[model samples]
Target: MLWVKAFHVIFVISWFAGLCYLPRIFVNLAMEQDGAAYQRLLLMSGKLLRFMSPLSILAVAFGIWTWWFYSFASGPGWHWIHAKLLLVVFLVGYHHVCMRLHKNFVAGRNTKSHTWYRWFNEIPVVLLAGIVILVIVKPF
Candidate 1:
């Protein structure tokens, strides 16, 4: 079980690393004007999104393992877990939105400004803080 927890943390960190970096990539993608730069960023974002997908799956899988193995879902002081799951669902949605935005960028149809992406980039950061607090404090 400790091994499960350790791997869960590891994969969660991996997923969060991608989540943290991808939006900054979007920020660059949004701001880039040069054709060559655009192509370069497109390649970069595509590769990154691909790389992150499996990490997200592994993180969620390990989370499920932790929940099932530890039975944390049925335990007291776990309302925060429920909330954290909800936040994670939103985080997954955010991930898909990033994919869609990538598609839009690929199609040359992106309408959003770099400022919008800058704001969008903060979503995961805020969620990370919320999730960490919920897990550590287990605030009801």
Candidate 2:
């Protein structure tokens, strides 16, 4: 159970890093006006997808395990659990949005923009802060 908690925490951090950084990368990718920009974005995003996919899988697995295994009796970080779940929903949407962006980048279509991505990247940051607060403070 402690091992489960450890894994859950580690994966959650890694997952959050991936979630945050990928969108930041998209900011640069979005700024490209020509196919070169698209090419760079496609390559970088593809590489990042490969690296982050496994972390996401780990995060989801440990998160579910933590929930189903320890949630009720121990009251184990329920606020964090809830917040992470909400962030996970956002992650799912972000994942699909990344896919959409990937397709567009591969097809030589410009994504949104650095300006758009600057604000866009904050979504995960806000969610991360909420998750961290819930985990640390458990204020609910």
Candidate 3:
């Protein structure tokens, strides 16, 4: 169980790293004016997304295992767990949205500016902070 938890944390960290970095790549993509540079950034985002997808799955799988197998006793103060799960769901949605955005970039149909992507890049940072606080402090 401890091993599972450890790997869960490991995968979650990797997923978060992807969540953080992918948008930065999008920022570059969004700003890129040259066709070659745009294509390169699109390839980079696609590869990064593909790499992160499994880590996201593993993180959630281990989290579900941790909840069901090891820590099912949800009583008072466990609302944080619910909140964390909700945020995780949002994160998963965000990941898929990034994939769609990558597709848009690949099609040369991206309408968003680099500034928008720069702001988008900060979203995962905020969510990561929220999730870490909920998990570590379990503050309801």
Candidate 1 Cα misplacement greater than 4 A, ranges: none
The collision pairs in model 1 are none
Candidate 1, lDDT over the whole model: 0.91
Q: Give TM-scores for every candidate, taking all chains together and pairing residue i with residue i.
A: 0.95, 0.82, 0.94
Residues 1-140 of candidate 2 have per-residue lDDT tens digits of 88988998898788778778887778877776667666776688888877777887888887788777864424543545666577678876886787677677677676476898789788877877876776678776
Lowest lDDT 10-residue stretch of candidate 1:
69-78
Top-TM-score structure, candidate number: 1
Q: Judged by lDDT, which candidate is best?
A: 1
- Ranked by TM-score, top first: 1, 3, 2
Over 4 Å off in model 3, which ranges? 71-73
Encode model 3's per-residue lDDT on 44-64: one tens digit a residue.
888999999999999999999
lDDT of 2 at 24: 78
lDDT at residue 31 of model 3 (Cα atoms): 80
Candidate 2 vs candidate 3, lDDT winner: 3
